[model samples]
Target: MPASTSKSPRVAVLADSDTRWKWGALTAHRLVPGGRLDGHLLRGRATPTPRQLGEVDEAGVRPDSVTEVTAAEFLATMARERYDVVVLALVGGGVQAMLHGLTHAWRGRERRPVVVTGYVGVVYEKVTDGLLLRHGADLVLANSRRDAERFRAVYEGVGVDASAVVEVALPFLGGAPYRPADPYTVVFAAQPSVPAGRADRAYLLERLVRHARRHPDREVLLKLRSRPGEHTTHVEELPYQKLVRGLRPPANFRLVYGHMGEVLDRADLLVTVSSTAALEALHRGVPTAVLTDLGVREALGNHHFVGSGCLVSWDQIDAGRVPVADPRWTQRNGVAPGDAYGTAFDAARGRIAALLGGAGPGVIAPYYDARTAPGYVPGLLARYHLGVDGVPLAGAPRADRPSGPVRQVVRRAARGAYRHGVQRVAPVVRRLGEL
Candidate 1:
């Protein structure tokens, strides 16, 4: 690859959802003025559905410009084109796929794009050794100092050099100023399929309804991550609307969706069970309540909010209590919204520029090996062959072609089975259980 004649660096953001696209967009928007930024909607390993693409478009990302790429295509594109930097804005197995493909493409090559990896949310626990080992990134951007430290510790524990990890402030926090809504509104942000296995969806909604009934004048909004019938990265654990249909919700109760900034702006209070939105709400000075009725610590991961003074239980919400946020906690979390675009942002920009300017460090050897490790092969196949909807890389075996159609068929069959169980089998099962 030859050096670019243009003054600005060329960047490609590989994203699979609206959340990731937002993160990538922020990275692109903050680049030193005239850098070329292109956003791609990844298909395999963690591709976005059409509905997700629509939502991303609605959020102001140019849909026409956002190309859809599979793992093979991504690798092929990276190999064929010369990009100054390539940012990975994927989550879960998608990250593994991208890392594997990129590493495979750049193996034995002299020139390669600076691979950047980061999280779209706050890091609560130890950075997974598996993720770092498989990352294959030239740099890893941490959302906060705490996360950066965690990354360093994890890297060191895994015997990998941790110097590439850099701390950066949350970009989503730099949005519009907070404006409190009238009528004392409360928004219950719901997360149905958290990794910790907290299955209190019904209980949470019931609690919210009870809260709304107790105070008829105050508006209560059920802010869902994804509405019913909408495709999201997470599995549809519970259809919340169905649970509340028989509860006779108050006139003030409503389901809402929009930008987090807009939702929080209209919210006087936010209640949830371990959601990143809680951090966003706190950053805006909106009172928040972290529910603990189910008493599952690991599942909810709300323990991070303990010292924040925002922890509460259903008992407290029923008692009409709103938890106050601890200022020290906000500062410690690096989510202090009052920073006014501090030095962290500038530092991140400078780091990216330096990498583009050829001052960046070399790719760690462990990540290079991790891509081809036996444990990573399944994930690579899932993402590149079975998950994506694009052409396979040239010279790749026929067996490497994606089985997207088969996966879709299986998903549809599962959904159909679920509907049948609820409509036809549940009644009989309940009757037999009563006997």
Candidate 2:
């Protein structure tokens, strides 16, 4: 199909978190350079952190144009001003429900926008969540060929057509020129909330701090996921600051917070329990280590690093032994430069173009279509759209206030309880079972 001769396609990206917004912003940036696209960002129920807002500004997404709108407002905007495409950079139950509402609101409309959705990072778990999101989308983008294949199997198991799934490279891998780091700079990319019993965040930080002490000349940077008081999806994270308090970390040992690319750029050796940052480090030719001292295989998602030869332990880091990543594993996992994993920027551009140029309104799953009308009011009132204190503008009498902010508070409390139980009570139960 030829390019539209009239005007650029109007695109809107709905994102929940900073990292997720990056995926959308990178895609939007790629689309704009083609001179045939106009992109805007919509703040979902999860408000953007200050760092995320900064990132959007830096990505050339005009701050004036970014809108913080309710789900009803989003749907109203879509209804009033038809967009060519609406990309969802969201996750979990919130996303699944949003997709349902969007499809329902647009049902039978002559000018419905294409719905594009996908996971923000490598999909290690939550297969069901991924499937639910994909089922209602016009195009479901996968992070790699391997991921695309996995999605196909999942779709097949559920008896849904898997033709909509397409493989695209990780967006962050593009355009950043790799610069070598200073000698003996080891960066531990911290993810404080892994599945329970997989890895200990404090233990990992302690080992790295200890290693830095053993070799005072080396710099050890603990790269944090978010700054203090910043909103993030990790509800149960134990901040690295809390973990290292009173240890009196050496001057050379620092807690850093910035872009992953910049962090990896200055890392001579990148250490992680099971972070996608390892893949980025390998892409930049940094010596990478997937710490396996605490857990192995699926427990810590170290299976993905198996053939990479980058998996290591505290002893190895202490002894100044950093294992080099295998290029084969890197290539297979879609980190290596090549067509095997389509270039993220280029793939995004082409996919959007194809969706716009193709005939018909695109596929709308029967499941979402059937649930549209019945779900409109409740979906509009759902927490992702309305704050816990918010009420519908008019019409039907309010049953009970459904505010997302209140639910978020409740969810966080539950997560705290769960984490506490897992840490304190689970061990005793396991010991009793062993006896």
Candidate 3:
């Protein structure tokens, strides 16, 4: 355990959105085994609102402090605090940029924080591309045994070190087995970008309305990730909340917000097009279904559940059909049986201990650099206002944290504008340009 060191190791988790923060914060506790932690929310289009962070924050593992910062400001903090571990709970581009950024930030230093990065959910798309961008982390977490194997294939194929990929279950899985509440409740876990088209989202909403009408004795909850003007890990072009505006559903049907775990407390059945919530439900033995109503396409992401035996349609469910997930499938995909979760993080902890236990921390460079990826790497770093050398570009404004009530209002307004641009402006502009 940490080589019996006198000083408790420090950890920093830099997350971009609400869901990532939930995964990352819990992961930090598991990695260090006994160290307190701090959080950094990257200033971006998808930064979590106060309510979002509040819902994800756990009792014991909540960071002692949380700071909002941009790419440049984060680099400065890393150098100043000298944390023992830094978790890059970000998108692939953010991780890649931060890898280079940290290399420069820790240059010539004897010790550097052991960097960790990984996906928060099922890796259905961009398998190789995502793996490559996340290559340099000292621990790249794979949420299942299957995930670890696939990760090795991609890295070993490209002559990159695959040892960093560690097998660990999703850190957010903890809930009692499903027990029926007074009224059977079915929750449709909505994703921000699963069905990107308005018509598709509306269709799903309409079907849920039909279900609520047909089963008046049942409670149907449409679990949403964000409110109207807020954002999540992905851009939501057509949010289910927006699509439900024109629907007249039964009184038993409603929209819910808060922790998915808390919602699962009363849920007898959970449904989703393609959400990490499906895994959470299965972990708790809640009856879960991966909807094939919209066709199990890769774009829809239900294809990842092809052999899970939990794939069924709204029509079948309407006919009182229940999909029983194959037990073997669940075990292979990191959905360990109930009560077996405590061991899931042990492997990750041992790996971190070995790194932080031995000689002073070492610096690891990313796969991409100015020379190896001349056409690509520079532009990616520039998006974060960082140069190819991983230093702040000249004239980049300082990203000091904003405070005071007036500034808080301004921050919310800015977030609203950014969401409008992503959901409303960018799509129209793209369509027009194509024409």
Q: Return the top candidate by lDDT.
A: 3
Q: lDDT of model 3 at residue 322?
A: 75
Q: Candidate 3 at 363: error in angstroms?
A: 2.8
Candidate 2 segments whose C-alpha is farther than 4 A from its true place: 1-6, 31-46, 59-64, 175-180, 195-199, 297-299, 338-348, 366-435
| lDDT string, candidate 2, 27-97, tens digits | 65554443333333343323565675676555455422565554565655565666676777776554555
Per-model C-alpha lDDT, please? 0.66, 0.65, 0.86
Judged by whole-model lDDT over C-alpha atoms, candidate 1 comes out at: 0.66
Residue pairs of candidate 1 with colliding backbone atoms: 44-388, 45-383, 385-402
**With candidate 2 superimposed using the best TM-score fit, by how many Å does residue 221's alpha carbon deviate from the native?**
0.6
Clash-forming residue pairs, model 3: none
Error of 3 at 147 (Å): 0.7
User: What's the CA error at residue 40 for candidate 1, in Å?
Assistant: 1.8
| Number of clashing pairs per prediction, in order | 3, 2, 0
Write candidate 3's Cα lDDT for 349-387 as tens digits.
888778777884566767778877899999999988889
| TM-score, candidate number 1 | 0.81
